[model samples]
Target chain A: MSAPVIFDPMTLPSDDNVNAYTFCVELKGGEWFLQKGKMIAYYGRIEFNGIGHGRFERLLRTSFHSPLHASDWVVAQGSGKMLLADRAFDVNSYDLEDGNLTIRSGNLLAYQPTLALKQSIVPGFLTLIGTGKFVAASNGPVVFMEPPIRVDPQALVGWADCPSPCHHYDHGYMTGVLGGLRSLTGLGGTSGEEHQFEFVGAGTVLLQSTEMLMAEQATGAVPHEPGVPGGGAGVPGSGHAGQGAAPRLPGQLGDLQRRFGL
Target chain B: MLAVDMSGDSVKAKNGSMVAYDGQMAFKKMSGGGEGLRGMVTRRLTGEQMTVMEVRGQGTCYFADRASEINLVSLHGDKLYVEASNLLCTDAGLRTGTTFTGLRGGATGNGLFTTTVEGMGQAAIMSDGPAVILRVTPQYPLSVDPGAYIAHQGNLQQHFQAGVTFRTLIGEGGGEAFQIRFEGDGLVYVQPSERNTIGGDV
Candidate 1:
C-alpha cells in the first residue's frame, strides 16, 4: 500500500560486517519466478593513488537493499533507462548503458563450451589472455539498474559485452620483463593503472570478494597513513606481513534454474 | 585491432589493470622498475598475458635489461600494495579466506570489501593497497571490469552477451557481440581507486 519509507539492508536480518560491508536480505513474499530487464549502467568516477579521485562520493550507495523476488526494474538516472522483467533484482546500476538484456545465466563464462541453452546469444561470458587464460562469469540472470555497481578487483571478470566472441592476448613473463624495462628508460610505461577488460552486455552481473582477498583484507591490508612503509618493486607500498605462497581466489560461472529461485 | 577507447574511473582499485582503448587484446610491456641494486626493466605492454613484477621496499634501486621481468627477492617492506587490475598473472594463489554472498539491496559489499582491515592484512600482506571489493544485491545490480576484479564468491552464474546494436539496432556487425554479465546476490571485491602500478605506479 505504500513505498518503503526507508529502503535499507540494515532493517532486515543482517549477517554482515559494516567495515567489511557485506549484507544480505531475503524476501518476505513471492514464489519462484524469472526476472528480466534492460541494463543501463552509468559507472561513477574512480579514485586513484590513495586519493578520492573517484568522482562523486555523494554517489555512494545509501541503501544496499533489494527485493527477494523477481521485480520490474528501470533505469532512473544518467543518460537513459530500460525495463527489465519479473525474475531477479538489480544490484546497482552504472553511468553507462549495458544497453540491453538478452540471455539467462547458464555456464555463460567458463572455459567449457557454451551449452547451447535454447536460442542462444551469450552476453555474460568474456575470454581474455592474461598470464593465465580466464573467463568472466555471473551467478545467474543479471538485472537492470540506473547507476552502475561499484566492484572490487577480486570479483571483476571483464567488460566485453560485444557481439563477436572475446579473444585472449598472451604475454608470458617475458613481456612483463620487457615492459618493466621500458618504464625505467622512459621508453614506455603506464602507471599500470590504464588497463581494463571489456564485457559488453545487459545480463546478470555476478560478483563477490575472492576467498584469498578476504584472508588479507580482514587485517586492514590497505595502505593507510602508517609508519614509514617499504616499497615492493612490482607490488608497491608496504604494510603487510606474511610471505610464501599468497592465497589465490579462483573465479567462477553459473546458471539460471539455481539463481532466480525458480 | 578493436581497441575500446577507455577513460575515467572514480570508483575503486580492482579496475587498475586496463587495456588500450583503441581496441586490442594484445599484452605488451608498458614499463619496469626495481628495489635494490640488481636488475629490472619497465615498459608499456598490452593484453592480459603480461605479468606485472611488483616490488615493495624502501631501498636503493638499479637498472637492468628487459630480459628479467621481475625481482622476486626485492619485495620487502611493511605493506606493499599493487593494484591487481594490471596484473597479468601470479605465480600461484589459493582461495583461503572469508566469504560474503546473497542479494538483498545495493550490495556490492556496500561498494566496499568484505574482509576487515585487520583481517585482510593477513592476506593483503606483502600486497599493495586494500582489497577491491564488489557486492551484488536483489535491488542494486552491479557490473565490473573483469581485469580489475580480484576474486568473487562461488555462487554466481557467469554468462556472455553481444554488444552495440543488440538493443537499438538489428542484424548488423557479423552475427552478434558478447559481454560478461552476472546475476544473483553477492559481494565482488576490488581496489577502491588505485591500481596495480606496474612499471612505475609507485
Candidate 2:
C-alpha cells in the first residue's frame, strides 16, 4: 500500500482545484461568498458568518441582492485555504471578466466577493455579473456549446453572454392534434426528447454530460406581480391555493390550450 | 479495490468485503474485530460495532465495498482514528479499539464512539469518493464540516465548533454551523461528498 498525498496550507494550490471533485481557495485576509455547507475543510483561521450578520449588511446589499436565498449562503472571511466540494460531483472554476452568466442556483458553490449576484428573471436561476472567479459543480464534466443550439433541460448547466434561451418543441412531434395528444398524455409513447431549451443570438451554453440534475433548494418565489414569469396566478396564497407547487414545464401552454388542441 | 498480499501473514478486513483472491486463503470470522473478549464487549457497548474477518495464507486478496474509493494509509506507531464503516482492511500488526469522540461524532451523526487503529502497518479506508488528506499544524489549525470528515491521525486536538447564534434560531443560520476544529499536527481525511448529518440543513 502506498501513502496518500497529504496537502498542507503551503502546498495547497491557490484558487484552483485540488482534484476533480475538490477545489481549494486561498484567502489572504480576503473574503469569499460561499453557499452554506459546501465547505468540507479548511486550514488557517477562517470564519463563516451568515448573510444576516450585521457586519455583512453592506456586503449583502452590494453583491447579494437575493434576500430569498440569504439563509442558504455564508461569507467566509479571514486568512486561510479552504476546500469546497459537492456530492462528489465534478467542480470547475470560471473567470468572468466583466461578463454575465446565469446558472442553475443549485450548482453554484463559491464566488469572489467582487462579483454581484442577482436573482435572474428566469426563476430558479441566479445571474452573476462583473469580474471574478466562481466555482460550480456539475453531474459530469461541463461541455461548452455555441448558440443556435438546443439542449435537454436537465443537462443544461447555464448560459453565458446573455443568450436568448427559450422553450422549443419539435415540430415533427407536436404538429397535429394526434401529436399534441401524444405529447400531453404520452398515450402514443412520446419520446422524452420532444421539448428542449433553445438558445439563439450569441453566447455559449454550458451542458453537463449527464442529464441528472442536482436537487435545488427553493430560492423562494418571485414577486407576485404581473408581467413577471412565474408570477401571479398559481403561486401559493395568491388565492390560487390547491394549484400545487409543481412548476409549469417550459413548453406547457396550459391545460386549456392543450385540451382544446390549440 | 485494495489488494493485500500475504505469505502466511494475516490481515483483518470488514466481513464479506473480499471480492477476489488468488492462491490458498483461510477466512476466519474475528468476533469483535479480533480484539478479544474485552474488545468485543467494548465494541458492543460503544455502538461502533464492526464485523471483521481474518484472512490468512493468501497470495493476493482483493477487497471492495459498494465500489467506493479505497485510500491506503501506512502507519508507524501513531494511531489512526476513523469511522468504523470507512475502514476496509488493516494489517494484522495493528490493534483496533473503540474510543469516545464526544460531540464531534454526534455532530456527524456517526454515534458517540469512533474506531481507532494503532501500531505500525498499512490500513485501507473507504470513502464515497477519493478522500483529500489535509495536514493540520500548530500554525495552521483546520476546521472541517462534520459530514465530510472521515478520519484523522497523528497528534491532534479536535474541538467541536458550533456557529449557532440568535440568527440561527431566526432561520438565518449558516449551513455549516457544525464543524470540528483540529489543532496540532495531524492529517485529516475528508471525503469529497458529505454524509447526511443533522446539522446539514441548518
Question: For every candidate structure, what is the RMSD over all alpha carbons to the true structure, in angstroms?
Answer: 27.6, 3.1
For model 2, residues A1-262, the per-residue Cα lDDT tens digits are 4557889998999999999999999999989999988999988778888888899888877789898888788999999899999999999999999999999999999999999999999999999999999999999999999999999999999999988999898886656657666666778696798889999988999999999999996799888766577775554456643344465542345643755765
Q: Which stretches of candidate 2 lie over 4 Å from their true place?
A: A234-262
What lDDT is reached at residue B3 by model 2?
89
Model 1: residues >4 Å from true position, as ranges?
Answer: A1-262, B1-132, B137-141, B145-151, B162-179, B184-186, B190-202
Residue A146 displacement in candidate 1 (angstroms): 35
TM-score per candidate: 0.20, 0.93
What tens-digit string does per-residue lDDT give for candidate 2 at B76-167? 99999999999999999999999988889877989999999999999999998899999988988999999999999999999999988887
Local accuracy by lDDT, each model: 0.24, 0.90
Tens digits of lDDT, candidate 1, A28-96: 221111111111111221111111112212221221012211011111222111111111111222222
Chain A TM-score of each model, in the order shown? 0.20, 0.90
Which tens-of-lDDT digit does each residue in B67-164 have in candidate 1?
21111111122222222222222211211111122221112212221221111111221112223234456555444422223444324543433333
The Cα error of candidate 1 at residue A38, in Å, is 17
Screening candidate 2 with a backbone cut-off below 3 angstroms (N, C-alpha, C), the clashing residue pairs are: none
